[model samples]
Target: MADIFSPSRLGGTSQAVALASACLSILLVLYLMFFADLYRRPDATESQVAQTLEGRPPLDIHIEMMSLDPIRQTVEARLNFPERRADAAQAGGARVRLSDGGFVRELHLPADRAAGATSVEFGLDGSISAYPFDVYRTDALIAAFAGEGAQEAPLAVQLTVWERLPAWEARVVSRPARPGEVGLPISIEARRPPAHVVFALIVYAVMAVIAVCGLAIGVLAACGVRKIEAAFASSLAGMLFAAPMLRNAMPGAPPLGVAADAYVFLWVQVALMIGLVLFICAWARRGSPP
Candidate 1:
């Protein structure tokens, strides 16, 4: 019974194996380091554009922003406009309207309307309802106010929130607040990363074996060593099954459940890979045909 895990029993090829393993390990690590750039986050302003609107003049306004919640699928906003009176000498008053081009949009108007400033909300449903990673929703509110003479029509504000529905869900909340405090609630979420560390051990073991064996076989072949042909064939077959495992291994790796916990997991991976390579090399050496 050959104990494949015994390191000392591996044939008298430790020197050659060590040299080959070190070179192979460095090369594979370097390849991964180069490819890591593709997975990095882009550098740019955190605030992203959402919507654009154009309207008439005379509407001087200020906006106050609030918090946004994507899990609940809702956005709360407030709009403040110049005051206006409908009945006065120069027949005037401010008129406000809300509009959206059916971009999965929903609006929640203030339950209570008043003369000075008003609050409104918009909700989106479906896919667009959810917040996107690296992008924030932008709602365009257009306020058009015009009046002539003594009693200028009161400048009233209309809270119009427009968004695409189905692709997302939108909710609007309104509350009374002092003047100079009104804004649109914007929600931003990050896209999830792919590797999951929890199931990574299996992958590490598999890759170590493949990479180490490949190195062993390659070295033997380059030196015109005939006996290594069988080991080379096995190494090639093992590597094919290991590639996909590495791709999925990191994304699903469990997140650091607590602070500093990731360090423990990382060290474990390092140790496991080292142990696996040494064990595989020893076993392969011992198994070499007489």
Candidate 2:
């Protein structure tokens, strides 16, 4: 047994060490992934505001976030106008207009059960300059209308303020109807999840490595510090195309020319292209080898 563990069989020991290291790395990665997922997971998938609306209601709006569209930059909201009370319209009105983000939406009081729920969309107004890190704000104002103009009413707002977006998380705030607004003004601020932000940073890091490699190759080849190979140009070309794919791989990547594109993806592409050109020039400059 001692002989089996002797220096003469160090290869086995090295292999065992390598295997253990690999296993340890995998375990660490899994642990991190799970921790990240748990940390980024929405505290509650659905924020049921059951108790929010108690009384003081002739009309109440159940505003549910249906989904978010990063591409179109819109938020889908489902308003359940349950047939409950129109007499609560305070000013003796059977109609209410929801003014949100400068758009006016009206739902008939004591909504017709046959008509079901009313759907409204609000534009996500924010800068997508820093994608994955971009934050958006959307709000709504409610008022009861006797005929045309909206009137203030004591509105009980029940907010179901949590929704798990594909990459973003919505944090909704229910602000009670102030002076002019009727029901309540719901303000939603959505941003990418922590895990997603971390993932995007990792992607940027990988892209940085690629860019550095390109710069190194280009500088080295231009300086004639290393023997240049024709294959290097092809490798650069491949990376030039593949780098965009890596950018697109982001959980919910925005269009080209985003902040990341300006900082990482675009630069990485430039690096590879420059490297390819340098390598090609060097390859051509060098005469036939012996």
Best by lDDT: 2
TM-score of each: 0.27, 0.74
Q: Model 1: how far is 287 from its true place, Å? A: 36
Residue 9, candidate 1: Cα error in Å is 8.4
Q: What shift in Å separates residue 279 of candidate 1 from its native position after superposition? A: 28
The residue-by-residue lDDT of candidate 2 on 39-75, one tens digit each, is 8664746664421345444344566677787666788
lDDT of 2 at 99: 72
RMSD of 2: 5.7
Candidate 1's residue-wise lDDT over 1-290, tens digit each? 46654665565457679989999999788668655843673432212222222332233333333444344434445555434322211223444444222233322222123344455544433232211221234333343333434533333343333322222223222333335422222332222222222234435545555555555555544444534334545545545445444534443233343222232334434444443454455546654566
How many Å off is the CA of 175 in candidate 2? 2.5
